[model samples]
Target: MFEYLTAGESHGPRLTAVIKSLPSGLEIEVDKINKELARRQHGYGRGQRMEIESDQVLINSGLRNKKTLASPLSMTIENRDWKNWKKIMEPLQLETEPQKLTNPRPGHADLAGALKYNQKDLRNILERASARETAARTAVGAIAKQFLAEFGIVVASHVIQIGNLKSESWSQLKQSANFDLDSKVEFENYFAQLDQSPLRCANSEQTKAMQKLIDSWQAKGDSVGGVFEIIVRGLPVGLGSHVHWDLKLESKLAAQLMAIQAIKGLEIGAGFEGASQPGSLVHDQIYYQPKTGFYRGSNQAGGIEGGISNGQNLLIKLAMKPIPTLAQALASVDMISKKAVSAAKERSDACAVPAASIVGEAVTAIVLAQLMTAKFGGDSLSEIKRNYQAYLKQLSEF
Candidate 1:
């Protein structure tokens, strides 16, 4: 099984992640991981902090000569802003007084976390709750992506909706075509086109409109959020089992997506829309060919049925609520004064759907990597490949 844990405050000297149980002998590419960290920082309407920080991952342990030693992997990304916050965030006692945050931001973890931990200063809660932690997760996911790539699995994401603006390409695909209408080759072309977009969106018109909304909201001291879709391709059938509820693929994917800050909703394939339709319209039709084996004509179930992969492109969409930290703060009560006050204001993005889309891809990759490892057990990449190839051969025979 694959698992990871992260440690660090938002303004701490560095963020750290420890990932374990990765198969041995898998090549590690520092540049590829750094590129993912860079992607996590890209997006329109990002805060000034993005400009101050150039995130680069340092692999402190687990690899020897750029290859995994089958041991725990440890990584870190230095927080450049730490220089300015050293006194405030320093671990040891300081001569200077610590900045105390009394007013909690609405829609953030500040108040809830502070109350739960019996903290007087909200900074104690907000530091770890900040989205900055996603940088460490992105680095971990980059490893999962590399591992999955060894088996031909690829993950990608694009913003489908931003506030009131929705991608026309997504609308077209949902309304005009069967879920399986596009071949893998065709989808790759679409992904290539979206990758060129500033917001990682497919439609230029919608993206422009979203950018305008972001600008308007920023000027108003507000923030906005929207939806992004994640797609995973080249997965073999039966990665997840229907035998146990916790082992279900959809369940695992949902938990991971919801863990990201501001994400409020998740959909798999035609999800909520399918709920309103009849079984005839919602269920994918099955088909089989001599060479292709079993397949689906549509994928309204999102390449998963009965909690198992059905050998089609996995589709998922995430909905993110507007970030809580606003320049024009919302109403709240001061923890110390016990009086009505405005919410705390902090440096934050007006919109982060584009960047969240990348994080979504990363998390999804990690889940799929876990499922793949579980299904094809091995302590080394070569052993896993051998096992997976045998499973493929068995499937072909079946």
Candidate 2:
């Protein structure tokens, strides 16, 4: 199975990611991965960490001479602030008194995590639970995206809402999705454009509007959240299996989306909207032609049905909650003193919807690539190339 593991505290020496089961001979680029990290930090309402960290990945294992080794791939993203926090985050028993976190932030993993582990200092929970971990995840996801792009797929995301302001439609976004996916040059260009944009949105008007909404949130001295969407094209059929819950593509995709910081909800095409529809209208109607192997009239099922890809576009939506380091902290009991108090204060963004969209893109890429590797079944790029070419030939001939 395609898999990944992450380690390191939010304020520790560095973030680490180990990805396993990538096909060998697939080109792995450090610069490309770092670019994704840069994208994650570029949004309008980012916190001070963005200013402090310029994330760059250090590949340690599972790659040599720019290609996968088909083993576990390990990476490191050094925490620039680790030096200053070394004594505080030390794994060794502290010779001095550990900084105690009495107050816990509302809507965060702080208090619950500490209580579950039976810890007094909420800092033990909040340190590792911090959203900073998303930086490492984005690095790993970027590699997965590179794999998907090699197969003629295009995936990009954008912010659609901020606080109370929401956009109705981003019609211009539909124009940039053309794909002859699965190539070096195309993948480079595809991400290049996204890296250049402020909103990571294809539509200039929509991006400008998003910027204005962010400005409004910044003025409030409060935090907010918004809706974002990941749009993809050119995915083939049968990337996931319906036979098991763990194998369900949508379920796996949903889990990855929800795993990101501040993301509270996930939806696939016409997701919740299907609840109101009768079964007849909810599923896509099948069509076939001599030239076209199989097709769907509409994609309400989000390119997946029966837990597998059905040859249509994938549309995933992510709903991010407001950043939790609220300018006005919520009430909580102190872990050390056992007295009620305001939550610990931390520098945070007014909103992170746009940055979260970048995260969504990374995770979706990882899941999709994992499925593709599983279905195609190869440990090296040469084997994968032969199998993929044969499959494409079959599709074209059929």
Best by lDDT: 1
lDDT tens digits by residue: candidate 2, 206-307: 677777776776676567888888877778877788999999988889888888988889878778988999989888888888776777766788788888
Score residue 136 of candidate 2 by CA lDDT: 81
Q: Candidate 1, residues 1-398: lDDT per residue as tens digits?
A: 56999999999999999997689999989999998998888889899999999999999899999999989999999998887999899978876998799999989998899899999999899999999999998999999999999998989888988888887434357566554435667767777777668889877887889999999999999999999999888989998889999898899998888999888999988889889999998899988899878877678888899989888889998999998899989999999899999999888988999889989999999999998989899999999999999999999999
What candidate 2 gets wrong by more than 4 Å, as runs, is 93-95, 168-194, 202-212, 277-283, 394-398
Ten contiguous residues with the weakest lDDT in model 2: 167-176
Q: Relative to the unseen true structure, what is the C-alpha lDDT of residue 165 in candidate 1, on a scale of 0 to 100?
A: 87
State residue 157's C-alpha deviation in candidate 2, in Å: 1.2
Off by over 4 Å in 1: 169-171, 174-186
